[model samples]
Target: MALRGTNQEFGRPYNRRIVLESIRLHGPIARGDIARRVGLTVQTVSTIVRELEEHGYVLSVREEPRGRGLPPATLRINPEGGYAVGIHITPLGIDAALTNLSGDVIESAHREAPNATPDLAFDLIGAMVNDLTGLRPGGRVLGIGMALPGPFGVESMSFVGPTTMTGWKDVSLRERLAASTGLPAFFETDMAAAAMGERLYGLGTGYSEYYYLYFGVGLGGVMVHDGSALRGAWGNAGEIGHIPVVPGGEACPCGNRGCLERYLSLEARGRWSGSDADWVAEIGPVFRNAIAVVENLFDPETVILGGLASTDLLERLAGSATQLPNSVSARRDRASPRIIVGRGGQYAVLRGAAALAVSGVLSPRFGQMFTAERERGRDLLQGKGMAA
Candidate 1:
């Protein structure tokens, strides 16, 4: 669902974020249009816009008037107002990206850290941040967003599996990153980060409710509802790779037999020597079954396929897995395709890691509904001598 703003005194920050969200999504937009879209008064929107301009978060643009008294000025995000760095960690390597307020990737770096420990990952991250920050001297860096392999807080799946990184479960990654980079640090699973990237700057932008099926080192998914990620109680909602698609399939380090990732992931494909087409043909049936399960379970507006895979491979997989099984998504009145590839490119997770900071700044949090007004993720931002 679209976010709406309230006129209450306590909701001022939320209103500001709501206005920023509107502008980021549709700008250069008139203040009147933003007011109508976000359920706020024109006066309230104007106040917020003025404050945003003073803070250098929004810029005013003018268009030629056809025959009006004066050309109206519109608002847009100021690309140089802020910057964010995103880091994606996996057993295979570490990826980092620096993005501006407009979500454009300005610089990126990749380093191999096979079976990386916390210390090793931190070292790589420090080098990346230093190099990235140098590109824009004295740039106002909003924060750092880190995407780690997940199933966090779970013993069996957190750090003891083939898909996840190990020797770092007890380390406070967020706090450490904040200290090392001298910036506020935000954290999320790689899957969640990828999904969040899609939500803010990719295919999920057009749909509030959609399933992001990530094709990374392993298969993962995230169900986004009302523009909020449906993170489970323990923050591992979309570990679909562990689901048993084959009754007696290959064994997974998670202690599951016939797990979906065993037959439908990059790691699975790497074990085979066949050509790309041959690999797709081999896993076509398994892929279709997984898609069917995702559709019936989430019933999202559409399912997005993306992540560390190449565009050609992702499209080939999407094309080859045809004749989809009948499910709730097969209704005749559907407005969107049942399946579509994400447009965030191969480094989507890295972009999402950056977006974590951007969203934290521009998007209102669902958690604010029950709690008193406060800075989002301030606990991580504070005590590190960083501004929130």
Candidate 2:
């Protein structure tokens, strides 16, 4: 129906944000309709629309006949007026993408991860951004959103396991990256970024709640509820890769035996190097078990298979996961299958990273703004947002 938590009492900034979001989501729609739907007064919507149009954020594309009155103008987001960058750091490599306000990829680049020491990686990132920006000068850039593999911000470097970026302990990513690139940067777990990407442009277009199983050099996952990630209290919500699947089977760097990824991840298969038939055999039971837990735990619309893993391989994994336990999502007339293989493929996390950048420009994050205000609004306060 109407948008969430919107009330007559909310101020101009809030109303303007809702107007902007409405135009982005449901435009070339009339301002009159936006006013009716978001419960804002016609004068308020008209003023917000005028402000947005003057700022190059919204454009009056066309007009619709209104029977006995002047035709109403239809407005939509101006794709070229703003741009965003998404960067995904993986054990295998780093991927970066530049996208317009509409989330369309304008350009992309990739570099091998082994070359990415703290200094080198920063330089590479700066160079990549320069290349993308230079392609078409004069486009306004929103900022960069970075997706990194975690257990992030831990003090003592782990002797072994997934938290293995060398020379990175105590090197604050947001602080360092911002200083190096001279752009506001936001960081998130790769899987969570992928989930947000899907939320904006992929499977999340249809499903509100789903599980993203990201198969990379390592395995990770994120559960999406509503349109945002379910970031736990400390922001370390999704780490399903370390879940013990083959109990007492293999030693894991996360200090567990038989972690699910140990048996079913692509890296594990690569290290072992078996035939596809042998590979299928090795991954089946663990995948089935992981599905059982994932399906039962969240009762999401489906389990999305995504990340750096190839679609052919993900299909095999999805095929092998046939024995899903009974759940609320398994009802008759179910629109979604138990498993959905992602189409974004390798760029899923990168696209997700881009989505975060777009969100910073379009969505209202009062919670984040207030928290940054406590810090005197340094890098986090990209005042460029809320306006666009």
lDDT winner: 1
In candidate 1, what are the lDDT values of residues 1-388, reduced to their tens digit?
6779986754766787788888987899999999999999999899878877877788999887789577778999899888999999888998898999877899999998898888888888998999998999977787789998787888766776667887777889778998888876788999999998888788888998999998888889999998888998878899999998888778888887999988888888888899889999999988988898999999999999988888888898899766999999999999988889999876688888888877764576634321432633342212233232
For candidate 2, lDDT tens digit of each residue in 214-325?
7776677788887678888867677787788775888877677888777777778787777766797777877777787887888888889987777888888888767666
Evaluate residue 176 in candidate 1 and report its C-alpha lDDT on the 0 to 100 scale: 91
Cα deviation of 60 in candidate 2 (Å)?
1.8
Cα miss at 290, model 2 (Å)? Answer: 0.3
- Candidate 2 stretches greater than 4 Å from native: 1-15, 36-39, 63-71, 153-167, 325-329, 366-388
Displacement of the residue 69 alpha carbon in candidate 1, Å = 2.4
lDDT assessment of candidate 1: 0.84
Q: Whole-model lDDT for model 2 versus the true structure? A: 0.74
